[model samples]
Target: MTARHVLLLGPLLMLLGAAYLLPFLGVMRWSVTLPEPGFGQYHAALSDPLVLGVIWRTVRICAVVTVIAVAAAYALTLIWVRGGRTARTLVELCIMIPFWISVLTRAFGWLALLSNKGIINGWLQSLGFLSEPLTLVRNEFGVVVGMVHFLIPFAAFPLATAMRSVDERVLLAARGMGASRTRIFWQIFLPMTKNGVLGAALLVFVFALGFFVTPAILGGGRSVMVAELIYLRIFQSPDWGLGAAISVILMVTVGLLLGVMMRQNRGAAR
Candidate 1:
């Protein structure tokens, strides 16, 4: 608005342009430059069955993880909203403890627990619950489990914020009017927390789409997702163009979600 403001903003704008915008521009350039020019890489990405399968698998896994994460977060939010101090403390600890741990550590921990001779199988065998160890790790089930573990916190934290922001007087008034607990929760509480729950679901889904580490280690290369396939293409093979094409696609998908999120926030503010 003024010379002083322009002077103050110039340095930050320049820094952002140099540090962030230029690198993104480089990636965009590489998508077309590597292995000659044109849209051949993108055509391969969309036409190849392998690439298409990976994208479909990613969508399916993310959908399952989002559903489970949202449902679990909903239950946790309910406890945090309605339960006593001790219960709230326990829920807080559950959400907070994993937030501090590294993703790699968490993935390896799941690996140790889910392997054939892992702790869970040992316990089950000792208790005679199963005749043989179940195939748990290095598959879709293990990948989904690890992903859900990572995403639950993302889901819970936002819903908790939303539940807290909801006016308690609304619920109290509903109670005074003789509304049943189930009815109040379904009708009032659900509607009130809709924004947070949907926001968390979208957040988790987007994060899960680009997930690499857990699926990489836990999926055991058998269940390769788009991110891992991109990794292999870029690093293991000489096809940097294909990798760049997929990266651009992924970036576009994330950008679209971000745009929708911004629109939603603007509407909420309005």
Candidate 2:
């Protein structure tokens, strides 16, 4: 509430507000009153079977990715917190490395690893385990794997920070009281970190919902996310109104989830 703080934040807030609101307003107008005008696009976007399927697929994939990423991150954070310095540093480096790498590069790396002539298939073939290459790339499995790899770091960093905030003395006291490790974890650790877990899950879910590059590269047209569909509608079909409608839907859905998360976080703090 200082004058200096207000002066610095005022212009920045204005710029951010304009940046978000302008395009959003444009999209909203197009969604409700474009092409023929007056809600036709929105109605079609809601009632069309293809659109509904794409939306459902996007939600389903995001849910699966969120579950896998959050579960893995929780276990990894526990290990990282308890690990030696060297091990924790190595894990941290592994997580950071992916974040710095380009999504296209990561997708290509996954293709190289999962393709028929890739290392995994070669190893299996060498071991006489399979007569043919397994289908890993260009499918739901590949999409999930690549998405999880990208999202795991986002999930881990937040949860790890939350875990570190927990008082070690509290855990020690639980142990001294003859509580089992599982009981201590369930009763103490999980409840304390619930907010962090919820926040990470929301973050990962939103990111996964809007994911385009990895799914496009790895899915190979087999798995179609809503983002990809929007891209196709705009650039391929040149149906700007339909594409705008889809974009509006995505923005609204993510915005509502974020609003709920913020409310829940505020309640937790109180």
Candidate 3:
């Protein structure tokens, strides 16, 4: 609040403004000023069937990824909270190993494993499980698998925190009262971790919305999401105005989701 405090914070604020704010402003400027100005680009992006379809697919795929990732995370969190040291170490390794790997590398790894002639199909064919390989890569299924693999760690951390915060005495008391494991889990444990699960879902959903590399590499241009579409519009097709318009729209959508997440956090705190 003092002048000295303001002076100390000024440099950091200026650095953020220069690094992040300015480029964002430039994108916002291009969205409206290019192609003779106005909001025509926004109208065009929204009205284009291809654009709409890409946006719809992005939302749908992200939603599915979030659901699966959160469920898997919940199970992992349970193991993390209740298991022995070896089990916990294994779970930690599983989550953190992929977390450290590059996104592009992970995508290509999935591509190799899921492609038509990939390991899974090869194994199946060798075992006489099928006459032909199943289509996995270059489609929605591959995209979802790649994304869910990427997002599980993101979902796990929050759920683990929530699970750790749960009171052990409450669970013990329920068990002493002859409440079944299933009944206690459904009635008590799940409700306590509801906020964490919701928070993880929203977080994963937002990240998945803007995913570019995984979808692009795995989808193989066959399944285009909004981010990939934006790249294609800007670099491949040379449509800066439309690309910027879509970028701005994507930014706004992410902002809205973050806002909802913050609101939920506040409600959970109370």
Pick by lDDT: which candidate is best?
Answer: 3
lDDT of each: 0.90, 0.90, 0.94
> Higher-TM-score candidate among 1 and 3?
3
Per-model clash counts, in order, read 0, 0, 0
lDDT of 1 by residue, 1-270 (tens): 999999999999999999978987887787888898998888999999999999999999999999998999889877977799999899988888998999999999999999999999999999999889999988999999999999998888778878888889999999999999999989998898888887888889889989999999999998998899989999999689989899899989988987886776566556
lDDT of model 1, residue 195: 82
lDDT of 1 at 1: 98
lDDT of 2 by residue, 126-231 (tens): 9999999999988888999999999999999778877888889999999999999999999998998888899889989988999999899889988999999999
Clashing pairs in 1: none
- In model 2, the runs with Cα more than 4 Å from the true position are none
Q: lDDT by residue for model 3 over 1-270, one digit each (tens)?
A: 999999999999999999988998999999998887899999999999999999999999999999999999999979988889999999989988986799999999999999999999999999999799999999999999999999999999889878998999999999999999999999999999999999999999999999999999999998899999999999999999999999999999999999999999899878
Candidate 3 lDDT: 0.94
TM-score of each: 0.93, 0.94, 0.96
Of the two candidates 2 and 3, the one with more favorable TM-score, higher being better, is 3
Model 3: per-residue Cα lDDT at residue 170? 98
**Minimal lDDT window, size 10, model 3:** 91-100
lDDT of residue 98 for candidate 2 = 83
